[model samples]
Target: MSQIDVATKSPIRQRTQGLRSRIEAFVRTFEWTWTSAVLFSMALLFFLLISAVVMPSFWMYYAEQKIGWAGPTDLQAFLEKPFGTSITNPLSLEGYKQVRDAIAMGLTTG
Candidate 1:
């Protein structure tokens, strides 16, 4: 008999093996049809539309509200400090203040 024993496997390996088996069993139940492909594509398209377009629009709206601007210049200001600028430019209300504070305090070990 082989020296390797199933029960001797590490907990993580055992758990992963169990999860892989479960995933395989679940996937085997699915019928891969053209309809499924179209459905998946539509779902992916919807997700992309929402994340790429709708979400940024919402963020811009919220940032405009925070910055208290409602003019043509609002677009310029938002473009200057988009949602992913930095820690301080989070909403671009004041700008740089929060970044200064975060820098003053060292990052947590955890």
Candidate 2:
């Protein structure tokens, strides 16, 4: 139609145009240098965030494996039962074997 009518425009098209105009106006306010700096700072912060979480976790898992129960002291701490301590129900060797298997598969050795 040559004449514009409010009812003639599709609701979806109207909403899309409105949102696109808002975004364009927003982008126009910032220069390329400001945008690049903001983006770089965000990227650096994100990398630091991921490493902060991941590095400690990796080290903990690494320590758990490398400092495994070779000696009785390590074994005692891991089992939470001293060698002299007596208990009615002993821990299963199956769990111990599974841990060994996991260590072989590159999981934590402890």
Candidate 3:
């Protein structure tokens, strides 16, 4: 019984030592590389998300400052020009129906 216990203990110790060495080698070779890659990707995504939120607001404020007190009128003109030709005429129900049909077609196809 003692001989069997001694024999089993030696093999178990050897197996544990082999596992530890393999794990250490793997850590030494690839641990920091994978960790840094993941961290950098996360930071890049965070930067893009923050910029998406901030950049448009910054542009809007800059545009308003550039336009000064007449900004609202300028915005109305800018919005109106596109709708006049592209979407619908501001004065007509037929134009509104055309715009609605265009939007529905676009949604269904896209």
lDDT (CA) per prediction: 0.58, 0.57, 0.55
Off by over 4 Å in 3: 1-32, 69-110
Give the Å error, residue 49, model 3.
1.5
On TM-score, the leading prediction is: 1
Ranking the candidates on lDDT from highest down gives 1, 2, 3
Displacement of the residue 77 alpha carbon in candidate 1, Å: 11
Model 1 per-residue lDDT tens digits across residues 1-110: 24476667877887798799999998989787999999999999998777666665664555456745333334455566756457754555333333333332322211
TM-score of 3: 0.32
Sorted on TM-score, best first, the list reads 1, 3, 2
Residue-level lDDT tens digits of model 3 in 30-79: 74568899998999988776666555555445444563321222334444
- Residues 3-88, model 2: lDDT tens digits: 47667888888779879999999998966688899999999988876666665556545545674522222443446543333365
Q: Please give each candidate's TM-score.
A: 0.48, 0.30, 0.32
lDDT of 3 at 23: 91
Query: Comparing 2 and 3 by lDDT, which wins?
Result: 2
> After TM-score superposition, what is the CA distance of residue 7 in candidate 1 from its true location, in Å?
6.1
Clashing pairs in 2: none
RMSD of each: 10.5, 11.2, 17.4
